[model samples]
Target chain A: MSRSSRTFRGTYFSCMSVQSVSRILAVAFCLVSACTPQQEPDQEPQVRILELQVPANFPEPEKVMAGYPLSEEGVELGRKLFYDTRLSGSNTISCASCHQQQLAFTDGVALNKGAAGTPLLRHSPGLANLAWMNGTFWDGGAKNLESQAFGPITAPDEMNQNLQELVSELTAVPDYVASFRLIFQDEIKPAYIARALAQFQRTLISANSRYDKYVRQEPGGKMSELELKGLTLVQQKCGSCHAGDLFTDNGYHNNGLDSDFSNHSYEGIFQGRYRITHHPADVGKFKTPTLRNVLVTAPYMHDGRFATLEEVLRHYSQGIRASPTVAAAVMQGAEGVAGIPLSVEEKQAIIAFLETLTDYEFIQNEKFSSPFN
Target chain B: MYRIRRSGFYVAMLAILFLAACKEEKEGPAATTSVTVSFQHVVGSEPLQLDEVIYTSPAGDSYAVSNFKYFVSNVKLISSAGEQIYVEPESYHLIAQDGKTSFELKEVPAGTYQRLELSLGIDEELNHRIDHLGDLDPSNEMVWDWDTGYKFLTLVGTYTGQTRSGGLVFHIGGDTNYRTLALELPQPLNPRQDGSSQVLLQANVNELFQGPNLIDFDVMNSSGHGSGPSLIAENYTSGFITVLEAK
Candidate 1:
């Protein structure tokens, strides 16, 4: 038989490559002699059930809180609901509206307007490895993920959704109702809504960065000479605040962003940790965010004042201003200077190192992407 | 062994017979009365007709309310003897200006009560755990958005552009600012052992401006962002509960 016309084990043949033709011939040759039919590989889902895959070298991640067990059905339901717009009052915006997957879950803007077109004061940061976070939001106001999901959904300026009516609305959709029933085996409720959302968010693990791979000593994970030098500098300087494998100390600090509070508009000056802690000392403190995808999640800081990593590095170098509650470390310089000192070359090296922290695998993970999209 | 088995069977048969006899005698679950509390909203002394450009704030701001919604939870009943009976799950309720009527208590104990109490908004400790707590669901229009807290009361409408410009929006929420205010009113009730009763809660919209915290709509037209809402919200706590019409 012709190579193109040949078939073996119910598989069609096309001799596009010599390797493929040889494999086909070998299979045919085997069949001609004496053989049993080969079986086709089992069909898998487009997006498989993802578990929190911690790297071998990485420390044990915080456990998913009790009562909020990560179930396959729940994660699947949460994945669907994360993109569903019904959570918004206008039904036009969903959690995924601001948290798109391409830009490391951020919408790629300094600040996106809420559902009511009210310009948000703070920029929406990218979400990854959130199960390890002790608190939620820039202010750390939300106690847990359950409380965090409700913020944007019911925020007047954001989705402005009425969570009380959300269950009924979701139940009206036959597919959603069926899916919810399959997981909960009971009526849809707001608690379940929060649970499903939390479940899905827990699956957003991003531990495959080049830096992570480098730590694992895997191929393509080797750091360049500049990157290695920058890593040494980061360990000496930035490592105090942005520490550990997650690249976050999980503590609040005022990074000497502003000097005078009067410069900000009324209620516009975010009081970060003070709002949650209510301590006078925490006047301008903000929770240290994870720099897992620092390359993609630009327009940095709580209010997104810095637009580029260069600006961020510059802020660390010499841009920090005087503030009463500014961290002692940030204010430490040759003569108790406001900001840290950095040369032009050092800044480039640091930027190069920060770029290695990018994890293309996590950002492009199909399971984390909106099923609806 | 046979004798013991015979006696055990007799005991089981007697137990079943006794249970069946009790089931036949009793009508259903325990005979308790339901007390329906109807909310009657008013502007000054007249029935409140929403969207009517008639009501004027004490601050001389001519305003017409398009939306007036507030949460009421943890309703309690106190008898003449000071015996308290609290509604389970806190009896969270939403009383809005439009299309909202009486909230019924399906399992209220029958008694002659002289005092009735219900909180204006959700309790502070219970507020943070707002997931699917029935009526306190964020999906309910009564929510103030999630970041800050639940809005105890929302009075949204258009007012004269003297104090502030544009549409008047007052979303009163937060824990330390203006928490739940428990309103205790004199309520004389005589409920039957297996019957229902009614309690009409009249909320005078005018009192919202007249109370100790005199609200000037023009100056405080909108306050969902800062400590401004608490000013008007404080006044509202006392002003909202006008009367308790028990029937």
Candidate 2:
């Protein structure tokens, strides 16, 4: 091939004969005719009908990524894997072990234990409206739910499973293998597992709260006079960091939890956004936990430092501790004071308002429940 | 099991058919060459040694690396003829201390490549794409488990004034303001007739504490995945990348 191309390379392209052009045209036509496929009996690949809605008022997922769209099969498979303790190294824990569906997906404890009852550093976060969350985890590590799945699954203090070995184990299970084939058409790998798990997590939409209904002007969504007053105060005072409909600005802040910037590792000390960005000002910062399930997802804060909404409001009243990286918004409130001062009546009213954000349907959703049980 | 076995049989048959066809008509190694790039983490003239005090910065900050690793990805080779050959999907790699730093360019078009363009960290697309595998695999100590991005470069060491018992941890890699490093080195090379060549690259660690933006570890001997004015992040961003040889 090189010898023939080399011999004609210099002069063959510069000149063309009429007969040669006719011959080339004839050959091209013949090739086109020869390559035409006959209409034969064909088996069309099955297009699985996926019923995934992005939920009302929630933004559409940036784009359903190529190849891994949110499908029912994928979500169901994910649900099964989420509850399957086989994904854990000790075969004792699963995602549902910490993120139970009953507690609005939170483990409802300060720092939840992992596979051998090892203490996990941060509180097991409640998972809801995660489809809108651009980042994952308390420190906002793991990028997205897919990559985030790797964290707890492989962490020594968590489920503690080798991903490759997990894949092999899943392959040994016929149900898992069949389920994986239904969604992925490819063999079970860490990628498929992550995709399936992410697919399931994204469907944990919690938008039917009383607060949402009240905003949507639906029946049974009416707020009390005190709750209405609480809403006004929430918008005026707590809207900066816990801003937007999702009730989180989705950014990192040093919320005055710790004065010192010292941590054992990069992601530890709950380094917050700084751990992700490697910036010094990010020390002692953590992602603002979503207030969607605030009432139910108790034991609050990244470290579960606050046990109740009253404690949380009281802390906010004191304002954040003096730290170099304390969020500028946390330093003052609607009253322009260091902390957001609330009268006892006002605190009770706001707590009432926060309760309206809870959705009973979300915690008890059958779709997100374990396929195993 | 039956499905896997049948698929394997089909794959073997296709491989045999492809080999026969290639032997019959194909030529010139498919106009591509596999290139190996070895990144030598160095301090001064010798190779950088980890957990041992064999190096000192120009600023007199005596240090020894306990751990050092960085990502080198988004590799592209630009020829004199303005041709761009990219190492896609698998372009992202981890260059860790006592780990594999040799990156393979599986199918860089075999030709005279004048300038080799690369990033010293995972690109924003891959970093943000949550479901990536292979080198971006989470097991690799390359990922920042808390944040959404990869720690583009991590150099941990026992230094003169490290307050933390662990040591001085210099972690730099971000998509937002901190940004990934785009290293475009003028590399002239011709792949061997066998379609393989070794590209030598150097990463000088002293550049972090000795350059125009020198780090004063006396007052601050540590930086985590947090934000602050890091002279080390500033100096190390552009100073560490150097192509020793492209042949």
Instruction: Name the candidate that leads on DockQ.
Output: 2
lDDT of 2 by residue, A178-291 (tens): 777666665677867887888888888888989888888888788889899988888887888787678878777877766776665634545666655556777777888778
Give the Cα lDDT of each candidate.
Answer: 0.73, 0.72
Question: How do the residues B1-247 of candidate 1 rate in per-residue lDDT, one tens digit apiece?
Answer: 9999999999897566445434522354545567778888887767777787567676666777888888776666667777545343346677887755668776565667766667766666656545544566556655532353577888887777454645777777767554444444555777654555777788877777766777776566677455676676677777677546676
TM-score of each candidate structure, all chains considered together: 0.75, 0.72
What C-alpha lDDT, on a 0 to 100 scale, does residue A223 get in candidate 1? 91
Worst 10 residues of 2 chain B by lDDT: B20-29
Compared with the true structure, model 1 gives a TM-score of 0.75
DockQ of 2: 0.20
Expressed as tens digits, the lDDT of each residue in A66-162 for candidate 1 is 3345678789889999999898887899898889887788887888998878779888978988878867787677766766787787777888877
